[model samples]
Target: MCQRCEEPERPEEERYLIEVLDQIRENGWCVQGVLGTGSRPSWAYTAGLTAQGLPELVVTGLLPHHAARLLNAAAEQTLHTGPPVPGEQWLLPRLPKLEIVQLSAPAAHLHIAVCCYGAGIEARQLVYADSAGRFPWSPQYNSGRGGQPVLGVRHA
Candidate 1:
């Protein structure tokens, strides 16, 4: 299940909510609840962001096989490894010092950041909720001799 976090003041917000629910249904993830009660006051969503800054794909009562399949998919998409570019910077804090790489001609410039928690495990998974809109950007560093710091648009 995926949560679409939002303030509910905009038209697109409402539309996105509908789409999220529809996608959950299509994915076969059960609908948990709209609002959360008890200790937390916010609406309860099947999927949501944890206190840590990572996306949560909440799954409840799934068979072991299904759970394994989902987890396997997540594991497969770990950061793509490459060398650091001459002047690119990595902004994702939780991620390990970035290994930037520069591509050849014809290809658009590419910047990749890998989470450096462990051998390959991410310390925390980034949560992407519908209501939340989007996650904050990671701060990046310029890679010049006296590289300037380029703050990411998103906060830590």
Candidate 2:
């Protein structure tokens, strides 16, 4: 029998961890998405950047593919230019200016990152603006139910 057959099967979590590590090794980061409940908006986050001494990223109220694209772009930028600090505004080509806010409760929101990198993992939420260029914090901005949820307190 092959040496591979000698050992017992690994648990799902272990297998998942291996896969995530593989992705990180290949791509510098891995994106994970969480489906929303009726009361929560869908969200996605990067999981591997923190290992590179970069803050992981999160975005809410977008479809999985959209969120992944945004995160991937941001991750690429961050890798080349270093991570953005909380309260900084980042402008990506063809996208509205994004506000970077440090997550107050990363452990509560970034379950996947916490599982992979533990509770100490740092994360920043990329807060997108509306079509009218109004951010969620703006009193005049219109956000329907389950719209973008800011995972942290807005910086002054």
Candidate 3:
């Protein structure tokens, strides 16, 4: 059986997409907006800063074997062996291509949206560093620096 997390509040089929996804976002990156037409593989993407200081949607979404595969793919792509200094930005010369797989009934359907924006970052830039100083992104720094409403625009 799955390592269920308290069985959740809603029924097994409720999706709870917003609740779960929002919780994931709390781990890192501010959710600017969610995209999709209520379709099976909709995306809750966040990318570059919009004119309103909100994260822009560049692209992108979880569990069971299908979800595990997706998460693993994303993790593999974003894996790093170093940390970034302040003001240091990484240029993504190429964006990795992802293959979207569709899962069916009772198979644990989940969507894990992972995107790398800014023309200079991988998907992992959205998270803070680990205790060993891995990722190097500080949620506080991210919010304090590029966060806050800047009259709806990025300031140099």
Candidate 4:
């Protein structure tokens, strides 16, 4: 019998897991979005990249669709160029430069990745700059409160 059948109590959870697995089987990765609360910024992350030996990608502050596009593009690039190291900058065509930072608290932010890959899963945050090209750590960067949540520490 299938695992889902074995654990009939968690029908919803099983269904969701099946969906994630199916997406990963068809696409290279599965993107999950978390809507932000009043004090938090919205974020999106990839769930299956770790299976490909690449750290999952996370991007915060953008709309769900935009974040998914960025994660998908980054996943594709990693398939060709290998995973990016923390502190490295990535330039995708027609998008702002993104700085990769290893997530300091993956368990806290990446619930889906943790659920899929367990506690030891790794992820990198794709930090984007404001319109003026100033990063979040910049003193003059323009953003509303909780506009862009940096999931990792900035490496100088």
Residues 1-59 of candidate 1 have per-residue lDDT tens digits of 43334434557645655665465446532223323234332211122111123322221
Which window of ten consecutive residues has the lowest lDDT sum in model 2? 1-10
Better of 1 and 2 by lDDT: 2
Pick the winner on lDDT between candidates 2 and 4: 2
Q: Which of the predicted structures, 1 or 4, would earn the higher TM-score when compared with the native? A: 4
Model 3 residue runs over 4 Å out of place are: 1-5, 8-15, 18-22, 30-44, 47-53, 60-91, 96-156
Best by lDDT: 2
TM-score per candidate: 0.20, 0.89, 0.22, 0.89
Prediction 4 global C-alpha lDDT: 0.85
RMSD of 3: 16.6
- Each candidate's root-mean-square deviation in Å? 18.4, 3.1, 16.6, 3.1
Off by over 4 Å in 4: 1-10, 143-146
Model 4 Cα lDDT, one tens digit per residue, 46-127: 9998889989889998999899888889899988999888889888987888898999988788777787889898889999
Q: Which regions of candidate 1 are displaced past 4 Å?
A: 1-10, 29-72, 75-156
Candidate 3 C-alpha error for residue 111, in Å: 12
Off by over 4 Å in 2: 1-8, 143-146
